[model samples]
Target: MAHSSNDEFFAKLVELFDYRKGKDHGSIVLTQKRLTYDQPLPEATSDTILPDLHPPQPMPILIRATNAKGKEKRRAKEKVKLSTVVDADNLPAFFERYAEVCKVGMNTLKPRDRRRKGKAKKKKGGAAAVGGP
Candidate 1:
């Protein structure tokens, strides 16, 4: 999961760690000497006070819009535009908008998929028979 901000990522990491440990009663230990700008695998294990491992630091978010032709497009031209950085307070709104845009895009891509099952069955003259008994 790509995070829009370091703070958000950190918060999620803490939450995940706490959940994994089954109890939030330990200090997070960063034994790994190097800290890179990337999101660590959620399953990474750490042998520290906090049994669960910390999520790796995430890099800055990059906002890039693409056109129907698969070419990069300007944010203004795209139907959905995400900000480069978002804090916890605004993250929910950002996600809500993002999900809405994704839903719209998916709907536009396959409108037929939204058809009712009964309507589809009726159009196809009921369920087709499978292999003979």
Candidate 2:
């Protein structure tokens, strides 16, 4: 039963493939389109309709900082996104490779310490520190 379901999903995924184009990275627009492809459109009940697509832009305050330090901070954090549309045809292969890598990564990953490292504890036996007047 699970095998048949997986097959069906694979078939659907293959149907969305574009053979002419290929990519090594993901795209937000493509992801959104793929996600909402089969979904039913909402009824236009209201007069005011909002647009769906909006590109990311840096905050005005961050870009136009009063001090040099603020501008330097923004420059340090800001990164250019070099995105390309991923080939839908290679999706299954890519996912399989990703899964294998993840399995290996999980094996190599070290367990993190959950305890918070706070201020050092004061000496309990020191008479000078706890002495009463």
Candidate 3:
């Protein structure tokens, strides 16, 4: 397999991230599971601390399908994102570098005023023909 360029890699990374725009109003709450209750239950009297466990990270994998003759075709190629186990020790450093790059990109953007001043409307007939008493 050949290595991809940094720009291509970054583009793929962004694509994998797949950030979405949030709703204009109200908040969106995410839940792992849904539960049905007849009435309100008692609140927790104490807090519980859970042990930290490292889980496998999910990474994207490009999958390709071969033709009937066992020939791989470009059109039949598909990207299958499969979960892979990997260490996340460098995640913090990666995030820091990403933030710095993002800051630089943001700085390059110039804020321009979008609102334009209204232009004066011109009269239909100039001076209205002085000859017509």
Best by lDDT: 1
* Top model number, TM-score: 1
How much lDDT does candidate 3 score?
A: 0.32
Model 2: per-residue lDDT, tens digit, 1-133?
1112323433333332221125333221111123222334444445535322321221111000011223566589532211122245555665585355334433324454233232113334344434744
Each candidate structure's TM-score, on Cα atoms with residue i matched to residue i, is: 0.31, 0.22, 0.22
Q: Give the range of the ten consecutive residues with the poorest summed lDDT in model 3.
A: 27-36
- Candidate RMSDs in Å, in order, are 16.8, 18.0, 17.6
Instruction: Tell me the lDDT of candidate 2.
Output: 0.32
Q: All candidates' lDDT scores?
A: 0.39, 0.32, 0.32
Clashes of 1: 0
Give candidate 2 misplaced runs (Cα > 4 Å).
1-74, 77-82, 104-133
Model 1: lDDT of residue 89: 56
Per-residue error (Å), model 3, residue 67: 32
> What's the lDDT for residue 81 in model 3?
24
Candidate 2 TM-score versus the reference? 0.22
Worst 10 residues of 1 by lDDT: 26-35
For candidate 1, write residues 43-125 as lDDT tens digits: 53455444224444433233322222223543445332222354335556755664554454332233543556765667654
